[model samples]
Target: MRDPNFSHKQMSAPDRLPTRGLPSNSVTPSGRNGVSSRGGEINERIADRIVRVQWDLTNLKDFWKVHSSPHRSERLAEYLNAELKVLEWMPFQAYDQNERVDYLLLKNFLRNQLSEVHRDAELDSKVLAFLGGFFPLRMANMIEARQRVDDLYHKKAAESLVECTKRIILVKELIVSEKETAEPIVALRATKNLEEFKGHWQEWYNFYDGYDPLFSYWISEPYPKLQKALQDLIDTIKKVCLGLETEDEDTIVGEPIGRSGILEALDTEVIPYTPEELISIAQKEYAWCETEMEKAGHALGFQHWRSALEHVKDLYVEPGKQPSLVRDLTREATAYIRKHDSATVPPVCAETIQTFMMSPKAQKMNPFFLGGDEIIVSYPTQTMSHEQKLMSLRGNNIHFARATVFHEMIPGHHLHMHYMARHRPYRQIFETPFCIEGWAFYWEMVLWDSPSWQKTPENRIGMLFWRMHRCARIIFSLKYHLGEMTAEECVELLIDMVGHERATAEGEVRRSVMGDYGPLYQAGYMLGGLQLYALRQEVVENGDWSEKEFHDTFLKANQLNIELFRALILGEELDKDYKSQWKFYEEIKRD
Candidate 1:
């Protein structure tokens, strides 16, 4: 189930509001901030009040810490009073459209928080009313409100079902209109739109099933039917866009950027390796890894890999023993990077990273580390089955942990996020996984060559495991998307070629295909890495530039397709029809 507040894409203003029930006045007007006729004074007053309330709430020292304390009710009451004070000041009808939307969203956020903190049914009703009044068109809010009302009143479930039917009809209209567009580009756009709509609708249904027992009981049968209808529409649209029935189809369906569309979208050159080429690369790495494992007194099989992983796990802090391991490792990596002057590590980034245990429900997903200002690490719990425990430990051993810590934190994702947030905020819409994932992968390669980080053969083997995994990702993901491989085949490839445990390989495949990541995201790790490596060799290694100089320049340039990045750094002329010419992987010498 999707968290209502969480979105994988960066939240736009409209996204912050409820998707279904937005009021007529909710949409922001084009010219200016859509100032109301009442005057600027009122708008300023409303904005000022919201700002002050936010400041007051945020400024309270240890406020969040107090949320889980024994006196939580008392703290919540005080917080609600402060929030009410802000709400009292808001002139919802008098403010500009932008200000009004902001005011409503803020109000909704506060109300929702209060309801959750206090478990107050009355407050929940009030929230429902507030959402319904402002966001009347949104199906998600309507369903939620209906459920809450039904819970409170013991009403018949027919009303919510009717509302669901209405929503389905409306969506059907959208789907039909979407398919009416016959032009390839327009059809492709429609495919994306439908996919997004289906995802959101599925989330709405899943959220109800997971969170609201009453709603789930009534809607259980209808939910699967609705989901299938959505999927059928999506599949139909994809078929038309990809020109599957045509003999000389040009488009890749759902992907507008061509066969190398992912690369083009990332402003990168086409990936140099074919499926066979990538498989060969993975095989070579596999053989090398086998040699390394033998030297470490392990053999080249699943059992030996498991034993080697256990040995490495034993060397590190035992799972669930202490929270200090990640933090200590992060600090050590930061210090090393700074000492070598490899790249600038911002103080804010180093200080702001927080760590937490991965939840049991999320264990099957096998999330090793998720990056933001905070990095989330998954570790095995006491309640986990032996297989689950093995899966967790197999992929997050001491050497693997050390190899990936910098990639998730420091001069990797955290630093990249920090710099981009401050310097090139507008370029966020152009974000592609290639540039983002590539940058981190490039650093892994860089540190591999640096004796300071990969000081031992074990560390090198750990690093190589991930490198080989990245290569395998490109091969398997591309094959899956091209209809040459199945999800099971992809899983087997990971297990056989990358030495992943059976469960771990399955989880990896699930994450790559069924998760929020795009079709090309798996490939981005290695392909992007190769793009950066080639660019570095051409510019920094050949031209007059130090490693630090090249890295600083690259980071500051913000996220761009590797091709445009090259053009910007090299001062090359760019054309609208520019296509990738560089075959980066072909230049590599494999022993």
Candidate 2:
């Protein structure tokens, strides 16, 4: 799975799709004008100006971000900071609550972008530090110089390409004899960067290759030479590196974004909690799940919940039977939600739900369900090893499928996309896990709270297994990012604390950490769900809104940081210098 948090459905599918947000270099389109439009030409709000600034910065980044150019990074950062300074001119206090929410979002969004630019530059420096002087910065400058002026000296471009090729050849030799072995993760990062550099060079060359006679004559012969040298260098480094294992399916090589990186990511997600505090939140959730699991175990005539959990995990629908089971569960969960009026499930969304089997390779990374537009079912197939098959079977048992079917389809991811796609589609740029996976997880909490779906002891344990798993995700994921836990340690925690099968645990940890997810993503499930639950308490339980109305309003609001949404929903007047001060978990704090 390329992205693990992409959830209009999962990040784009469900759990596994908890695809993290856009790439550091990707541009988010600021809506045509204004963040809000009720109908024909609503008055332009300050959000419009802020998004336009994003638009301007996004364009500046387009040309400024020349591969391997520090000036590109520095200039982009300076531009963003200048925009922030420009924002000081806005009359913030005069703005209404909705306008204020946009202002806060834009401010945080800008700051988060700046932090990421810093993180990128820092990571680039670290990775290049291990490059052993093999980097061809002159080539980077050539690329940068070309972008600076549309009319380039074609002959000069060709000369530079020839020179870069010679440099690359020499660099490969230096690497081959290099005594200092780079860290596997850093080496892999360097390898990827080098490849991108190779690509950038090719792109730069091709633009003038045949189009310009002098450029073609000078660059054509040398271009492939440089490309080959880049590849050779990449190959040599991979051979020398520890973590660059391409052969083993089980090898998980993730670059741990230390505490500083984790903190930057959390800020980007608008999560106020420290990684330490978040671990505590996960601990409480784990303890609560434990208490509930015990009651469910006791109901099932077992003294310990682990015994009951194991009992449930062992009960599966045999090989060919899983597909039917998933289909039936999807219908059952859909019907149940509709019957309970838990959320507004349009006929189209329910009727349009689709299912597919996961390939054996995909199953290695995400040995569970994935959802959004379609439900990706992960059950054992003929290709898997017998042991692998057993793990898949146990990991995705009938009750486990029942617990998450709606999560990947219907009222979970499918419904999320169904509503979000139709309403406020522009806001999808701000997609966060809290809304994607969190909303799906929130429904899990909602169903568990009401007690209609998990009628049997087996079902209760099944649901509790996932609930505990989400808690473990937070603790292990944050700890991994904080440099306190290894991927293997995180995997061990899942198997030990959450009763995950070894294969599922490894796949889960691999995708969560090694895949392209932000640091705080795993925490979003329990945290985002809890935030929604807290909001539910305030609105439905304490105030006038009904469950359907509350759910509908939130779904319609699309992807916002849960904190930002809090302001919109509650109509809170933010202080001039606002931060995520919502101690949302405090309302559910237990002694």
Candidate 3:
């Protein structure tokens, strides 16, 4: 479990959205981007277009009617602003909201193309191709765009993941609906969207579910209000879908009305920690880490990082001699963080490393030091203080520093993300979350055996207790998602397992309800670990393979589902046979 390559201050996984057609930062009025001329007109136009699309997309018939009109496709494209409010607002609510929004966006986009085909066969054929070709691209584009944006603005980026979850849910629902249906037309469309959608959804759920570890950290928000809003929305949606009458106000779903309570709680909750109290906790935590490193000795660094580096280096260079890997490692590590930072990097030569070192990527790295890479940490704004929010990498360094370096940097996420990011074509960004996050979580235990951390029984006990806490978290996700656990039960489990004296754990549960079927958080790591282990054995039996090569191959695959990766790596093609079979039905419909 000892990983030496881990660095502190690492950030979380990248966004899976594409940045194409995004207005340059300069065009933004915030001045964060360099394109600002005609800002007022552009803003107004963008706003107007978003409202129109949102309005038109609500009715399935309207969505299809308008989009299918001749000469309207280009007009529709002109109004589609990916950076507008519609895109931004969709991520903050329940799964249903996400579903409605994503489906509408896609449905409308597809709906616009009706004129291209008139016959049933033609319609079916075109729809299948459009869903197959366009939806995956759209999903990937959205994920990539958000990833870049998150790199620039950490807290906002972190908060945006709620939206990412929404988008994934959208794709997942579409995939399920497409695959299971008996209808020929529906099946054809399913053939188009379901493959990539299922692949990406499984990847997100299985791997990246636990990216924001500090989601367990307490903030000043009232957990109840957000829960109520989410519940109310769900109830209302169910009623409407069932054809039951609802109050007039209920029709306007997914609005952040009455959110002031959540906001107020964020601004004023009193956990009552003195500055001295935090520093005292930090001292205890820091000492604990030191003890772990000592026990782990060289294996901590080598296993987590250097060994892996040597392996990959062996692919090109001499086996035991030191290579220039460290310099490239440092540069790559820093650039990863610097790219993910929302705040500007100043040109001060004196503290350049230290300056970029405060990024979320760096904070995530603090957990992995003996492993020798940097961590990348990220969380929503409320968990971060205002100053920290503004400066991004600012505030109490020791807190994020410890978390990032120990958890994500050296032995952790940085190594994980770097490998994954490099391996695939751009589309793979949307593919790998569970593996990325699961690997980081696995190392949390690995560090406990480090020499520097085992000095005190309290440190050992604390780390053990924390692991138990994480275990509880995983169980909660499984039970909740599988429909066996209720929100109340989830809350009770958190209190019992993690000593939920802090509101952070409760907040995490509340957020979980808004994403996927349940808490598939730990499912990624637990399941992914099993998958990786099995795959490793299979490869070993087939051909002699190094762990380093496996690790590199794993990471470079860009967070693809282990199953999908297995197929691709084992020299199997993507399942075009099933899709080809699906195309037959489309051809049948067309003729």
Off by over 4 Å in 2: 1-44, 50-68, 132-134, 144-159, 169-185, 202-217, 246-249, 301-303, 589-591
| Tens-place lDDT digits, model 3, residues 266-307 | 111111222223224334433454444334334334433223
Per-candidate TM equals 0.57, 0.85, 0.34
Error of 3 at 586 (Å): 41
**In model 2, what is the error at residue 563, expressed in angstroms?**
2.6
Candidate 1 structure, TM-score to reference: 0.57
The alpha-carbon lDDT assigned to residue 542 of candidate 3 equals: 42
Candidates 1 and 2: which is better by TM-score? 2
State the lDDT of candidate 1 residue by residue for 69-93, as single tens digits: 2243455667666665435434454
Which stretches of candidate 1 lie above 4 Å from their native place? 1-316, 587-591
Best by lDDT: 2
- For candidate 1, give the lDDT: 0.58
Q: Per-residue CA lDDT of candidate 2, range 129-227, in tens?
A: 665443456666777776775677766766776776776666567666775566666676777788888878777876776777877666677778878
Clashes per candidate (backbone, < 3 Å) = 11, 24, 141
lDDT score, residue 403, model 3? Answer: 32
